[model samples]
Target: MSPKASTRVARGIITFLFIYLATPIVVTMIYSFSTSWVKTILPNGLTLKWYSELVASPEFMAVLLRSFSLGLLTTLIAMACFLPVVFYANVYNPQVKSHLRFITVLPFTIPGIILVTGLIQLYAELPIPKIIILVLAISLLSLPLTYQALDNAFIGRDFRAMFEQALVLGDSPFKAFVKVIIPNIRAGVLVAMLLTFTSAFGEYVLTNLLLGGNFETLKIYMYRLMRSNGQASSVLTTIYFIFLAFISLILILIMQHYSAPHKSTKEGAKK
Candidate 1:
């Protein structure tokens, strides 16, 4: 095709994609506000009753809180466990580097179904809160993400040199890590934490299979009831979408901050 035709085709494709992706969100927003929307081209009337009902439901609140806690706790533990292990392997234990790749890839290698089956079989006999099991399982999936983030943080910097320099300057090894390494990698760490929390919050299958109704989360709660109450479900969805979008914007800002130093270094080299 000629240039004009090619440009028009590209624009048409892009426009179609935008509509394709946004159609559900627009339809749902309309449905969420509608008093009655079934069997119609447009909603019969608009009202805030669904949202009001959701806000008043203590069950909904509790489920949301549980989901929030799961996300927060999972991120905390993933960060704690991955950071030091990565630091030690990079600086003190070079041989462990080869093993780390195999460990990180374990989550992706195993299917969730098989992993959960083994977990239930093993832990079904053990007496512990199923939520804890779910947390650990979810954290396994998050390990690679946080690991790569920390790895990127250490890529251009010398972990051993950084620590030894701090030692010469009269700082403990731990203090050097906290005072120097952390500030340098802070953005990557935040990105990893936020991504973990987001992934855990949206996770459903493993959670549903293991914790189920015993420890209600937003995902489980929605699965059990959303189909029965379309209006309410849409409202909850819109709320969650807004919340996730807000968090995503924060992640984007952190990522920009993280890349800034690298970008400046590249520009200086080019100069």
Candidate 2:
């Protein structure tokens, strides 16, 4: 085939893939606006009644708040607990890097249901809420994603040199971490937080099994609506998608802003 013909074929494939991926989200957005979509190829009309009702729902409000709060807490807790550990593994002990990577990835090897079952069995006698248990489980599951992001940042450079330079300049360990390291790894840290928060936010299997009806998250709320009211569920999904998109955009902008100085200077030096 001619080069132009091959290019046309590639463009067609790309267009097809984009539409294939976006079709579900587009369909859901349309359905969310439908006034009455039953037995129709196209919605008869469009209205915001479903969304308005959803917004006014106290149960949904509670679920939304809980999901956001839980996701944020998961991010915060993972960063606090994992950053130092990952830094140590990557920068301090080369021998532990392989072992640490294996440990972080263990969560992905186990089926979520099995994992949840194990947690329930182990914590059956604990006096804590199932929600806390679910949070811990989700955080564990997100470990690989969070750790990999930070580890990639650490691997591309010599953090020990930066640390020693700070010490030589009379900065304390904490001051060195704050002044030199944190800013350098800001993008990686933000990426980790975004990944972990989104992962925990959307996790349903573990949430369903561990908490059941005792603690309701947005996922649980959506599942309930899905059983009773499909249209309401569609609206809820649209709202959830919008919320995720908005937060992702905000996080990406912050990451880019922090990354700008280092990215530009590094690229310039490379050239």
Candidate 2 regions exceeding 4 Å error are 247-271
lDDT tens digits, residue span 1-101, model 1: 99999999999999999999999998888889999987889889999999999999999999999899999999998988898998898889979988998
Task: Give the C-alpha lDDT of model 2.
Answer: 0.87
Candidate 2 lDDT tens digits, 1-271: 9999999999999999999989999988999899888888999999999989999989888988888888998888899999999877876787998898899989989998899889888999989777788888888999999988889778567898998899999999989998888877887888899899998887788888887787788998898999998789999998889978987897778767655656757766988
Q: Single out the weakest 10-residue window by summed lDDT for candidate 1.
A: 258-267
- State in Å the error of residue 71, model 1: 0.6
Give candidate 1 regions above 4 Å deviation: 93-95, 261-271
Task: Give residue 7's error in model 2 in angstroms.
Answer: 1.7
Query: Number of clashes in model 1?
Result: 0
Q: Give the alpha-carbon lDDT of every model.
A: 0.86, 0.87
